[model samples]
Target: MSDTFDPDHLRAELLPLSTLQAPSEEAQAYQRFYGLNALGPNGATSSRIGRVEVGGYDIVTQLWVPDQPVGTLVLMHGFYDHVGLYRHVIDWALGLGLAVIACDLPGHG
Candidate 1:
């Protein structure tokens, strides 16, 4: 893992981040930094990462579903934020039996 919290280090560790997969250490560091898979829920009945066209722009998207979701949460991060930064919220919704669908803002992520 990188010694510092480099945003580049956090990039491209998996699908929807980069076309090429990176080392697990890098990916784990990102998860740890965000307190995911540790400080929050991590399990999901189903998870998907891909891209979609939104308003004539291609955007990276991710979806998480619980065993039997009662509703869905369309999460949006703050300014300059990407979908990965909100796993806690996503997991929270999943734990509450709700599906989550988040995407990188146009030209952001």
Candidate 2:
């Protein structure tokens, strides 16, 4: 079997921020100096989101605080995928009284 490559170096090479303009100057690209922005709204949703550093990569873990506090739900995405792509699924999870957690893997959109 082949050896596995360490991705910490590659992750460091990715610039922390982008300069893409948004909505014809009506909006601006989000900037970060230290860590990445999980790209989610505050309030109930944000309260459940947590930063998890695993395998040298940052993963956002979101938990839905249910009225009765049942169990946790973890959602894993495929290659070249971002956690935001599962908005519909997350919403469904909320309706089911289960927590939702997702992340944007490296080199993924």
lDDT of each: 0.61, 0.43
Model 2, span 10-108: residue lDDT tens: 233333222221211111111111112232233233223334566886654434444543566677889877655676676566556665555565555
Q: TM per model?
A: 0.62, 0.50
lDDT of 1 by residue, 1-109 (tens): 5533454444443445234333356555544565443321455455554556668866666566777779999988878887667766776777788877877787676
How far in Å is the alpha carbon of 100 misplaced in model 1?
0.2
Number of the predicted model whose TM-score against the real structure is largest: 1
Residue pairs clashing in model 2 are none
lDDT measured at residue 90 in model 1 versus the true structure, 0 to 100? 73
Worst lDDT window (10 residues) for model 2? 25-34
**lDDT: worst 10-residue window of model 1:** 14-23
Number of backbone collisions per candidate, in order? 0, 0
